[model samples]
Target: MESGFGTRRRTRLFDDLLALFLAEGFSQFTLDDIAAALHCSKSTLYTLAASKDDLVRRVTVHFFKRATAAVETTLSRNDDPRERVAAYLTAVGAELAVASEVFMADLNAFPPAREVYEANTAAAATRVRQLIEEGVDAGAFRAVNASFAGDLIATMMVRIQQRDVGKATGLSDAEAYTELATLLTNGLRT
Candidate 1:
């Protein structure tokens, strides 16, 4: 069984790997490169995953898991429904802004990594839909079809994740998310 120290060490390693991937992306890095970058043996990385592809997938999952918690924490701090919407999205944008363009491109290119992002997007859409419903019920927002609004936002989010928004509007995913929050709040305001 792994001791507490071993578990902590592994967690720290995962955090380090995630940071490296967020800054530089994983597609270009081999096991040797990652090991060298992390100042650990290849065996150390294998303790986290059997292969580099698995490591990348695990790191992507770690990124989203941490990001979701942060976004939720930001939303919880806002009492107003409108503020909650903006705060949630803005927090998401802030979390995503840490990732470089190369990282975004690499995430899009890798099917496994992209699937993790896609799942998170879907979950975020659901959360946004719930937030919209809360605003409408509380009369904080003008009456709007919450489902439709959520779907629209989700479509834009998917486009941003896929790099279509970047290609067409030259806005990074983070920028697009910020714009989305602004547009959504303005459009829904009573």
Candidate 2:
């Protein structure tokens, strides 16, 4: 059985690992490099994941899970449909702003990590769909096909996540999300 202190240490180490990955992409780090960077032993790092790729995937999951919770918390604070939609998008952007461009590029390049992002994007798209439906129901938005709009937004979001929008428009992911929120809210307004 693990002691409470052991659990806390592991949690702190995981937090540190995530911070490091967010600041500097994980693509270039070896197990030894990671241990050195985190001031932990190789065996200690192994406790987190069996391999570097596994650790990367785990950290990616942690990042998205935390971001999702924060976005939901932000959304809960707003009552108006328009504001709720805007808050959701803005909150997503805020959470993503912590990730460096290098980290994003690395994430896109890694298939396992990319899958996690794709799953989160799909979930977020569904959420946006529901928000649009709510707005239309509440008479705050124009009567349009909510599913279509949501699908369109999902496509744009995937493009943004894939770095295609960044390549084409010179807009960072966070900036692109902000633009999306503005355009979506304004277009939906009655």
Candidate 3:
């Protein structure tokens, strides 16, 4: 098992490295570049993460964890399934809007990050399924296969949100949320 200090140190190193990768673009960075960015030797980074692949995984996990926490907080505030779902989507939009451009750029540059990204997305879909199932049980939503519909809804919302972000569609976040809520409510209405 890792000691607390060791874990903390690794966490800090990972955070620093991730920030640098986001800022500098990961595809172009060599280990020496990372070391220079962190003001440390290459060996130090190797001590914390085995390779660049591991570093990307750790960074992707860290980012998605933060996103998941935010969604959880949004869900906890509303008991109504529709409201909770809306809040969750709004939270996601807000996150994407506020996310550093460098982060987006880096994500586009790193193909290896896709697996981690997909895993995070799947986890969010599962949460949405749980919420949908609860709503159905309470007669708030139509009786449906909560898992399948949830996955579909989650995938659609993510794609639309990404498109909006990439295109800078000029839609306000509130407008986007309202549009998504309307679409979802129509589909899920009893």
List lDDT for all candidates, in order.
0.92, 0.93, 0.69
Q: Can you write out model 3's per-residue Cα lDDT over 17-61, one digit (the tens) per residue?
A: 766755655767788888888898988888866998777777777
Indicate the residue-level lDDT of 6 in model 3: 85
Expressed as tens digits, the lDDT of each residue in 52-111 for candidate 2 is 999999999989999999999999989998788888998999999999988999999999
Most accurate candidate by TM-score: 1
- For each candidate, what TM-score against the reference? 0.97, 0.96, 0.76
lDDT of 2 at 156: 92
**lDDT, residue 26, model 3:** 74
- Candidate 3's TM-score reads 0.76
Predicted candidate 3, C-alpha RMSD = 3.6
